[model samples]
Target chain A: MTMGFEAGQDAFARAVTDPEAALPPGVTSRRGEADAMRFAVYRNNVTVGLIRALEMRFPVARRLVGEAFFRTLARDYMRHELPASPLLFEYGDSLPAFIEGHEVSESLPYLADVTRVEAAWTRAYHARDAHPLTIAELAAIRPEDLGATRLVAHPSAALVRSAHPAGSIWAAHQSETVTPPRAWQPETVLVARPDMEVTVRILPERDAPFAQALLAGEALDAAAAKALAADATFDFGSALVGLVSLGAFSARTDDEDLPK
Target chain B: MTRFDERETGLPRRSGLGLKPEHYQSINDGEPDVGFFEVHAENYMGAGGPPHRWLETIAAKYPLSLHGVALSIGAAGPLDKAHLARLRTLVERYRPASFSEHLAWSTHDTGFLNDLLPLPYTDETLQRVCDHVDETQQALGCRMLLENPSTYVLFEESTIDEIDFLTAISDRTGCGLLLDVNNVMVSAVNHRLDPYAYLDRFPVERVGEVHLAGYDEAQDGAGDRLLIDAHATEVKDDVFALYEHLLRRAGPLPTLVEWDNDVPAFDVLHAEARRVDGALAAEAARRNARAA
Candidate 1:
């Protein structure tokens, strides 16, 4: 009974992996001259369906590479990695890293960084949701012990600091929502669900340390120290004002009040 | 209260919409008319947050259904236990009305394809599918419904037809069918098989629910028509016509309109559900007169 089962799977892999292979006995494919043609349809549908799902998750990568080459890249990628789950949307978590080390993509070195930005952007969108502490809650924090206070950032807040100017590449993909970077420099991209919509903002060099420190769960004072070192001219007061406005912090808990 | 209980096997009302994370708010605000909601079970495999919160709120008022896309019952390999454990967790959270998966397989040892893949109808595959279904029914502890998939090609593999394979599984495990009308039409047209004939030959009595969706038609490299099940477009005209044919024959069962990508506003999906209601109502009226 299981003989046909194993035979069928082997036949399926061959039929999908290489379209030119002959169909198994008793297997009839209708599209081409023989069963091979018909099975080709299955191979095409599965391949195209998966590639399209990858394209949907990583549209910027697709746009950056253009249509034809991207399809080739996607096909090659599929050859190596098939889906382990049925949820199509969440399929390609490893493609960003894959592109980083892929030999064929040497020409587009920036592609991997750009893909990372996009991945972080998606992570922020689908991450666990948490309520940002309101202005009233912040007001409750006593100024006397503000430095020792630890703030929990919203779960969706993700910061990606890349050497490549990936922030600009990502921004350019948004059709009507264009914010052309004034200059191409290593930029820190902060992704957050400000309101209902997910927004990505390019961070200034001087202020990135603070955001990075805050992401590491550092207290406000320590994060500020790192921000100051990155740029002496860094304005802690102004940065905090902006970060708070973006719904970046979930809540601030006093150090002494921390659970044992 | 216990997070999830077995009583969740309760069915969503006659009119229910596909639950999407994007539409979490409107669902929470409570659309009493919406009755209940259903989700692709694989989406909520991870722990914590919105998927769980929203499911709890919606499940509280409206009945829920845990529809799945990745069970791969027809695969040559053994059933995936990790996948089943994730589903069991979801069952605890959502307490869905009906739990179901496709009568197809897309997973290989490497990973999942996400699409409901096609299977050859053969004696060997038949035994494999039944065994998988029996295991799944036992693991989940809820009666299951096996959904048919839309296919672009045919297999010349030896023996069995679509209905026969499904009936054999149904006979063995008492699993019901989730007949996707659009799939029938799409597969029938792609393979040049007759839609009416396929429908006429199916085991309608075993159909527990039905599905209606849209398709995009384009010419492949060789000029052969490829009907892609995009689900982004509105339900095709012919598909709706076929759906009416099904409701007339099967009576009023819980039906769904799946529009996954390029999703419009809440009103758009609501209007689509209302259209199904209109068709079902018309069919009942006609059936009543014939009885008279």
Candidate 2:
């Protein structure tokens, strides 16, 4: 008997996700044998395909965990999470959390954070493109208006904060040799695709407050104030020059600062 | 109305290869005489970046075809409008000579499975597939070619034959066909059917393009060989024979050699495409000699 579409899909989905599950009703292999062997092909395809998508997003994670170990972690995540959209690039939003909760990966506390930085890099790479604000544009802003200027960051800009030096760890993997620093240090990473090149740069913890504030739509005056509050040694001028050089902002509005 | 009727010209009757990102520089530098390049439409769905830039450079010289793997045309639910919109944008931007999707579904009510899951050949599915094709055509404002899936398992469901189902969909929706000879070979070997006989009954006239890919050989518990449409290796000699047979009957068509996994060097894929071109030329010569 022909199975209904919904029922057939339900069984097929279950069988693919779980190997022990029996083949869906009305399914058989050639030579009239059990469908288990053939069904495994689809199961393997789904598992392998999703794992590859995740691997593309988190190459550093793969390198950190090694090939076989990473596949095991990724397969566990795949069993629990299916891609909500056809966009494979956006499939690993939960990977950081998955790695964080994973007990086997608990020893590597910094792994999840590194994954978060990688995810941010991918999102930034695929994010919407826009002509970034030039240094000349910043210079053109009136001196008096500079503090009150509200900067608009490009869609391809992202800031990632982590307790461990995940950004450094990720960078180390990019080159031939990967050597962690002797001393452990927390890191804040800025990921952006300015001029169509994805760049990941590490920032001081003090810069997090300023970048976070600006990304949250705060005016420059309050953002700098918040940064200075978090860390007294924060150099506003150097930070501004660095950010502008990174092509961070897409537009800057000179709206008057509201009375505080 | 038929989109590929007398008023329209289909893809060039020559050989093409699936475009991979790694081969972008080599393809541009060497500028191979490939008739066209086919890419999965979803790969270029990014807003802007290297994908678009590379596609632009390639499109400037070669005809392109947007082959989609995520449309899920045989699913029970409504078509995903957002995905369809992205596809429309790509088609508009690239203006590929041919656009096609699999007859299988990769999506369900929950989320995309990301695999070309098989469907039972039944009247219910036929209606669902036809409706999906119509909806997709209406949304894209252009005709699409529906590919026959390479299925591993067979559904015991009672219904029409595979070729009839495909032809019915074509007849009702006025959609063209992307006859994947590798898929036919795989399914035929799996089902113990004659690959040649399967092609003998195929609707050659409705075929707008052709696909040739490699398969992995595996054995069942009974020790019988099974062919998996893995697209990982070079085209098998048997599959190539089937391709030659079909080309001799259908004349030269837009043929694509798909090597997605374990993608070989540019030279290797180019050699395969050239082999297909050689076959097409031979077919043309045979036809010309018969006419003379």
Candidate 3:
């Protein structure tokens, strides 16, 4: 194949950094801007393109950081990390984590949490289509097996725990700009696709502990025990009903591990 | 609303629309009445979605052409792998009748601009282009098409005329030409050269496909007219007139009606594709009658 792994990466770097500094045969380069200034236009255009794509993909995050700050951080992100593939929808999987670690964004401790919520929303929007268990289907499952029958979460189901009102922070930043004071209390987010439309909601602190255990693929008994221990008000009855209604699970199996 | 006549795509040497998402259902719901459907290969890079879904169904019905927008072939650097992988995937899936990209570069030290930016015509650049084309064809595992760009500015350092560069690229790389009639007219007028002069100089025999689309005649803030190939509005009369002129020489080829932004209804796009099919049909009949 003409395209090797190394050449493609190098070419992308050159194209992104200085578009015209190096030229291939038959390609004509723009002239007469005093060499240094010539590349400035292309450099600006490259940064602008990446920033705009990031803005489109993460509107809520951009709104949180405002235009100037977002552009600066987006520029840094693009320079350090190019997209692994052209599938832009899948681009920014690590952005939330990246933002949390950046020293410049350290003051805005909640910024990373807001970004995490936004990423979850994006994932839900393009998640694979699965047959959501109908209300009738759920009603058929006997209540006796409910405790033993593990519920499958929808492919888009994402439960995130944070120390900020990340859902409202992301939601409020949707249309207009605002810099509200971060809540001293922690918040949890539940992103799901109940219907064709994806929705994100804030979870009560009492329900937050269940997220890690479930997402970690722990057994049903262990997860419920963790959830119960974390919050006295963590009602298993309401949580089970909610999980089925939201199509949070793909399929269910008993907590008992089978022989390999 | 209909597939083009069977005879329109005879040799596949014609101008065609770069298929858009809006026209997918209308074009594929029936058969396309035009020569071919050329799409930005990058758009359909998705694993499975509207781009692939519609194109898959349509490619089986008509001759499809793959055009790469993010190749950044004209940049001083080498080809991009991820982009090429996607292109290779599209080519493997569609087995398209033709594949092509511009003499434009849109990548820099930063990342992708995702727009067709201009390149200067220099020997060093030409060698780079040939290498890229050769590499692209090898990666794609297919013969390629190279489209001339409708540039906004000229380089004082450019030694080769656009046509000569295209011809050289073809000779050395064994790639074909996707002659955009409107681009020829626009660039000739913008740079103060005769449009017909370009037609005469280009080796039309190597042209595997043709593209005819609308151009917005707007000047820069200084009022120096810039012919941007917007492809938004109707195919301009001058451009259509030029198409008629080019087709008379280049012979019948696959043509498309490209409208990316502010896409009108599906019927409007079908009508445009039908219009091209009608013209090509008339040309073919005229030749047949002459032979008779």
Q: Can you list each candidate's DockQ?
A: 0.32, 0.67, 0.16
Q: DockQ score for model 3, please?
A: 0.16
* Candidate 1 error regions (>4 Å): A1-3, A17-26, A30-34, A62-69, A102-109, A133-153, A175-179, A194-196, A218-225, A235-260, B1-38, B43-64, B152-158, B188-194, B215-242, B261-275
Best candidate (score: DockQ): 2
| Model 3: CA > 4 A from native | A1-118, A121-207, A236-260, B1-36, B47-63, B217-223
- Please provide, for model 1 over A1-260, each residue's C-alpha lDDT reduced to its tens digit, 9 standing for 90 to 100: 22366666766665675556665444443453343344555677778788887787788888878888889888878877877666555567778788977875589887887877777666666676667656667667788777776778777788878777788878888775656557778888888874446778888778888988887789889999988887899998778767766777777765353333
Clash pairs, model 2 backbone: none
Give the CAPRI rating of model 3: incorrect
Q: On a 0 to 100 scale, what is the lDDT of residue B256 in model 1?
A: 79
Candidates by DockQ, descending order: 2, 1, 3
Judged by lDDT, which candidate is best?
2
lDDT by residue for model 3 (B88-206), tens: 88788788777788877766555556556666676877898888888887888777778888865555556787888988988888877878888887787666678887887788787
Tens-digit lDDT track of model 1 for B157-186: 647878788888888787888888888988
lDDT by residue for model 2 (A152-228), tens: 88778888888898889999999878887555898888988887689999886887899888877898889999999
- Candidate maximizing TM-score: 2
Better of 2 and 3 by DockQ: 2
Residue B166, candidate 2: alpha-carbon lDDT: 97
Winner on lDDT between 2 and 3 is 2
Model 1, position A34, has a per-residue lDDT of 43
Give the better candidate number (1 or 2) by lDDT: 2
